[model samples]
Target: MQICVIGCGYVGLVTAVCFAEMGNSVTCIDSNVERISMLQEGRSPIFEPGIEVLLSSNIRGGRLCFSATLDDGALRGAEVVFIAVGTPSAEDGSADISQILSVANELAHKLTQPAIVVCKSTAPVGTACRVQNILDQHCASLQRIGLHRVVSNPEFLKEGAALNDFMRPDRIVIGTDDNQAQQVMHQLYEPFVRNHDRILFMSRRAAEMTKYAANAFLATKISFINEMAAFCDEFAVDVEQVRKGIGADQRIGHHFIYAGCGYGGSCFPKDIRAILHMAGEHNRRMPILEAVEARNQEQKTWPFRALQDQLGEDLSGLTVTIWGLSFKPGTDDIRDAPSRTLIESLLIAGAQIKAFDPIAADNIKRCYPHAVKTGQLQLVDEPYDALQGADALVLVTEWKQFRQPNFSLMRSLMRNPLLLDGRNQYEPALVEREGFVYVGVGRPSTQPVAAALRAVV
Candidate 1:
């Protein structure tokens, strides 16, 4: 199959490279010249695990290529065109699908042959229909006889495990009323789902809704556990034990059950907002989702609030070490990351921050240039280097390296041995046994009453 993938961001680039690996000729198109050039040189613009290797291998095999525009020869004679652009949350909370619409309009003029345009981006329901309408109007204007087929084929790739997710998808969703479009999509994805017939053919609107519903439900699980964690705190109960207790029921298998700082990335937050906006447009209210969003907003501040409960409300001149900066481990994406909330709050209170992440330190530094220039924020190379002379340490993202550390060494390096476990990665008793005062979200504070009261007030 000759495939053209538009908007070579995370989804588009991964989709193109994986298809090429499966013996399909793929041309990935993006407007960003620098990104396209990097891809053409066998470098991935984004830091996804093993993507650069796949991109290089596919390009060397003459199965994959990159281009800056759809006007180029990329879309010519393409069997399927993927609109994998970003559908970021707008200021009004709806998905800003201008990118998808723009691509549809561009394809209307550029496509030399009728092709299936797959909506690979996660958009609100009926977005594919809108794309179809745009293409139809363009076809009528051009005096073309046939209307282009549009399919809602939302991607379900995870950030860190994107390559694996694409190569072995749990299910392949093809949303189209057109039999030809459905058949082509199934055939294109047949290789990935060869072991089992996991292709689910459905209506376009249902497919779009499935994407949002899936993310929203996962987000709700995170929020639900966090809420339970908070409730357990009043009685000094370990949420970990309760999590295990509930997870053993088989009906509630553990997936997104970790009571972390919050859920953040390109998907959960944005998709939840988009779905809420869609509900509002139809005069419907989703109160459960509303509370879920509210809890997550409050949860992201757990680390900073915990820091204040250990140190004073005014964090002036305090040195804090942060273990992770990305939204989650396995990628460098920091969009709406809980680490940002803690960093901003600490900085605002006049605290000096020393942050370290194996891959995301540079991206975090780029986000705070003025702070970096003023020496207020330090992005360190070594994780222990971040702890040097620090008053407190907060584990934000649970990177693999931060799992087990020399707590004795950490205690000796810090000015004050205050540990705030944002992701509940450390056992409070074990951390306290290392001669450090430990604070964790929804966990009992180990500080002395007077000290704890002073820090909390």
Candidate 2:
């Protein structure tokens, strides 16, 4: 299939690369010249694991290409066009899909022949219909009505594992009332779902709603577990045990049940907000989702609150080490990350900070230029470098490298060996036995080494 994917961001770029790897000729378009140049040189502007290699291989294999703009008839001879632009949240929590609309209008004028336009970006209901109307109106002006077809094919790719997710999707959703459009979209995706007939045909609106519902539910699970963790804290119970007890049930098999700082990336927060805005527009209230959103906002501050509990309300004269800066472990995306909330709070409280992330340190440095310039916040090159003279170490994003370390070395490096495990990745008793004070999300804080050993016995 001849594919044209616009907006070479995370989703679009991954889709183009994966499709090209599957032997389809793909042309990815982006407005930024620098980004297009980088892609043309076989370099990925984004940081997704295993994507750069696939992208380079596909480019060398003559199956993938990049363009800076839609000029020179970029959509010509394209069997399928994917609109994968960003739909950021407006002030009122509604999705600002002006970019999608603008691309639709551009296609209406620039597309030489009528083709299937897939809305790969998640949007509100009727967005695909709106694009269809635009294309149809343009065709009517040219005396070729009903020549184009639009499909709502929302992508379900995660950030770090995007290549795998795209190559082996759990289900392929094609939203179009037109049988021809559905067939073409399915045929385009047939290679990925060859082992099973995983194509789910539905209305365009239903497809859009499915993506929102899926992410919202995952976010709800995270918030629900965090709430349970908080409740267990009040009762001196370990949320880990409670999580295990509930997760053992076949129905609630643990996916997002681990209590953590919060979930922050491109999808969960934005999708939840869009759902709430949609409910409000229809005069409906979603109290459960509202609480989920509220709980997550408060959860992002868990590290700071825990620090306050240990170091008191005023964090002045403190040196804190942060192990992770990205939103999650596998990617360099820091949008709305919990680390931001903690760093901001610590900055205001006059605490000196040292943070280290294997991939996201540069991005975090850009976000806090003044602090770096003034030496209040130091983005260290290594994990242990950040621990020198540190008062407390907070493990935020649970990267693989931070899993096992020389505890004795860490104990010697820091002035005070306070360990706050944000993701509950550590056994408190074991960490306590390492001669450090251990604090976990919902696990009991372990006492000194001798006391912890006695308690374990």
Candidate 3:
């Protein structure tokens, strides 16, 4: 199958490259000339694990191509056209469908033959119908071509592991009414669903709602665990133990239950807001999702407040080291990262930050240029470099490097021997044994209690 994926953002590029890898000729279209040029030279515009390898191989084999104009490439002979443009959040928290609409209008003008237009972007319900209407109007204006089918096929690819998710999806949802469109989409995705026929066929509206619902449910789980962590803090109970107790049950089944500094990324924050806005449009109040959004905002400040309680109000000359910058590991995306919130709050209280990440440092510097200029936000090359001359350490993202470091070196480099474990990455007793003040989310330092318990035993 020949495919054209519009909008070479994260989703579009990954979808196009992965499809090309699966023996399909793919042409990825983007308006950005520089980005398309980079892809033409066999370089990925974004950083995703195993993507460059796949992209380079496909380009070498003449399977994948890039272009600024869609009309000249796969759009002419494409069997499946994927609209993978971005639908960012609007002022009212609704998804701004302007980009998707623009692509739909463009596709309507260029596509002369019959093509299955698939919505691979996260959009509101009834968007496919709107696209169909746009295409219908375009065809009526031209008075030369017949109608085509528009289908909703939302993607569920995570940032870091997008290639794997695309190649081996857990399930593929195809929402279309036309039998011909359904058959074409099913055949296109057959290679991926060979292990099991996990292709779910449903109404267009249901498929759109499913994408939002999945993200909303996952966001709810994260916010629920974060609120529970707060309760555990008030009662002096360990949330880790609480998580273990509940996660042991097959019903609960731990996945997003780990308590940390809320949830932040490209998807969760935007999708939750978009759903809330959609509910409001229907004059319905989503009280649960509203609370979930509020809780996540507050959770981002947990580490800042913890540090204030330990270090007092005046942190005028304190040098604090932040271990992670990206929202999660394996990618350099800092869209709504918790580390950004923490850094902003700490800087307002007059504390300098020495932050390090494997990939996100350069991007973080772009956001906080003043911090770079004023010598306040120092982007260190290595994790230990951030610890040098630091007063305390705060672990934000659970990167592999920060999981187990030389505690002895950490103790020696810091002005105060304090460790704030944001993701509960270290054992309380282990850090305490190294003669450092260890603070976890819901667990108190075990040094004092461990000695007494050991004597009793």
Candidate 1 per-residue lDDT, tens place, 370-427, comes to: 9999999999999998999999999999998999999999998999998989888998
The predictions' CA RMSDs to the true structure, in order, are: 2.6, 2.8, 2.9
Candidate 3 C-alpha lDDT tens digits along 78-194: 888999998988988899999999999888888888888999999999999999989989988878444688999999989998988988898899898889998999999999989
Alpha carbon lDDT at 13, candidate 2: 97
In terms of lDDT, the poorest run of 10 residues in model 3 is 444-453
Worst 10 residues of 2 by lDDT: 444-453
Query: How high is the CA lDDT of each candidate model?
Result: 0.90, 0.92, 0.89
**What is the TM-score (0 to 1) of candidate 1?**
0.97
Over 4 Å off in model 3, which ranges? 144-146, 446-457
TM-score of 2: 0.97
